[model samples]
Target: MTFPIRTPDDLHIEKRDLKFGRDDAPPRWWHSNDPGRTAFFNALSSTFPVGEKFFMTAVRHYRDGTAEPLRSQIDDFLYQESMHSREHVVFNRQAQDAGFDIASAEDRARRTIAWAKRRSPIQQLAGTCALEHFTATLAHDALANPEHLGGASNEARRMWQWHAIEEIEHKAVAFDTYLHATRTMTPFRRWLKRSVVMILTSLRFHYVIFRNTADLLRQDGRNDWATWKGLLAWLYGRKGLMRAMGLSIFTYIKPGFHPWEIDDRSLLKDALRLLEAGKPKEMAA
Candidate 1:
C-alpha cells in the first residue's frame, strides 16, 4: 500500500480522429433534451479544450527520460488528450451555435486553468490526476446508466460515449506519471499532497460547472426560481448523477489505488466496437 504501484498493463490507447454532426436547427437541450442535463454537459464541453491541454502539459512535463510501457503510454496519452480537446472544441462551437453562452463559460474555465498553470509543475500534474479521477468516475456513471444519456440526440450521445470510453482507457496516465516522478517521497507525503490536491480540485471543479450552468440558464432567460429548483432536482434526485457518483468519487483516496483496480474494461467492449464502427463516418471539417 505504498508508492509506485503498477500502471495497468492492458491499456491500448489509440487516438480516434472523429467528428459529430452539428444540427442545422438544434434544441436548447441538445443532450437528453433536458435543460439541466444539457447545461451540465455544455459546461463540461466548454471546459474540455482548455482543461485537456493542462492535462497533457502536466503529464508531458514528466515525459523526459521515461522508459518502457509508460513512455509509449505517455505519448499516446498526449495524442488522445489532444484529440479530445479538438473534438470537444467542435462540440462546444455547436453549443454556442445553439445560442448557449459557451464563450462566457469558457472564459471562466480559462481563468481556472490559468490559475493552475501558475502553480508548480508537480502541483499541475497532481491536479491533473485528481481531475482525471473525477472524469473517469463520471464516465463510468454515464456508461453504466443509460438514463444519464437517455433521450439525447444520436450525435450528442455518440460524441460523449466516445469521450467516456477514452477517459476510462487512459484514466491512470497522469497518476502513473506522478507516482513515477515522485517515488522518492514518503508514502504519507505523497498521500497528503494528492489528497489535498483532490479536495481543492473537486471543490473548484464543481463551482465552475455549477456557475456555468447558471450562466446557461440566464442566457436561456430561464433564471427563475423554478429553473434553479429543477437543476437541484436533477442533481440530487433519485436518478441524479451526483447521487450515483457519490461513492465512486472517493475511490481515488484509497492508499494503494490503481485506475484498473476495478476492472471495468468489461464495460469497454461494446463502447470500443461502436466507436470503431463509427470512425469512418467521422466527418472532416
Candidate 2:
C-alpha cells in the first residue's frame, strides 16, 4: 500500500502547558492497577526530562544549517519537546510522591545523556534520531492500541495521550535534521553510523527502562517472579508493546528510512481530537 509522504510543511506545534498530579496523585498502580505496568511507565517518564533536553540540543545544533520548512520544523520540534519535558517533570514528581525513587532514575538518565553529549555532534544527532524513532513507534502503538495504556487514571491517561499526539506530530524532525547534518557524508557511511548508533541506543535504552522498572517494583516489594514475568510479558509477550513495534523499529535501519513513510497520521488526528476536547478553551484556541 502506498502511504502519503508527509513533510515538515505539515507540522504544527501546540503549546498546552497542561498540568497533572498536583492536587491528587494517581494510585500507586495507575496503569490497570498493575504494579509492573505502572512502574514501566513511571520508569519511562522519569527519563523524559533529561532525555528530551538531549534530543533538543542535538537537533538544534544543526538547525542553522537546515533550509526552509525543515529549519522551521526543527524549531517546532524543540518547543514541543520542551513542553513534553515540562509535563513529564510533573508526572515524575507524582511517581516520587507515590513512593518510588524517581530521582535516582532521573539521575541515571542525566548521566547517560551527559555521556552522549561528550560524543561528536553527528553521533549525538544520530543517537537522537534513533531515540526519536523509538518514541514515535511507541507513540503509534499507544494511540492505535487502547489496551497498551488502558486502565490508567484520567490525568495520567490524558497526559500520555497528549504526549503521544505531539510525538507523532514531530516524529520526523530529528531524523530530517540528522540527514541534513550529514548531507555531505557518503550515503553508505551515513547509513552505517545511524545503524550502528541505533543498535547501541536500543540496547542501552531497554536496559535502563527495564532496570528502572525493576527498581521501582522492588520499592513496592514486588521483586517476586510474577512481577518480573508480568513485566516481561507486557514488553515482549505475544501482545507485547515492544513485540508489536518490532517491525516498525527495524524499519529505521532501512537504506532510506524516513519516519513519515509509516503514515500513521490518521491515528494522530483522532488522538489530537480527543486531546483537544479536554483542553481549556483558551488553550485550544
Which 10 successive residues of model 2 have the least lDDT summed? Answer: 1-10
RMSD to the true structure for each prediction, in A, is 2.9, 3.4
**Pairs in steric clash, model 2:** none
Q: What is the TM-score of each candidate against the true structure?
A: 0.91, 0.92
* Candidate 1 lDDT (Cα, 0 to 1): 0.81
lDDT of 2 by residue, 1-285 (tens): 122225645556555566765666898899999999899999999899999999999998888877777777888888889989998988987887777887678878888898899999999999998888888888888888878877888779889998988888888888878877777788899899999999999888988887888888889999789888878887887767777556555788899888888777678788888776766565569
Number of the top-ranking candidate, with TM-score as the measure:
2
Off by over 4 Å in 2: 1-11, 277-285
Deviation from truth (RMSD, Å), model 1? 2.9
lDDT of 1 by residue, 162-200 (tens): 889988888888888888877888889988888899889
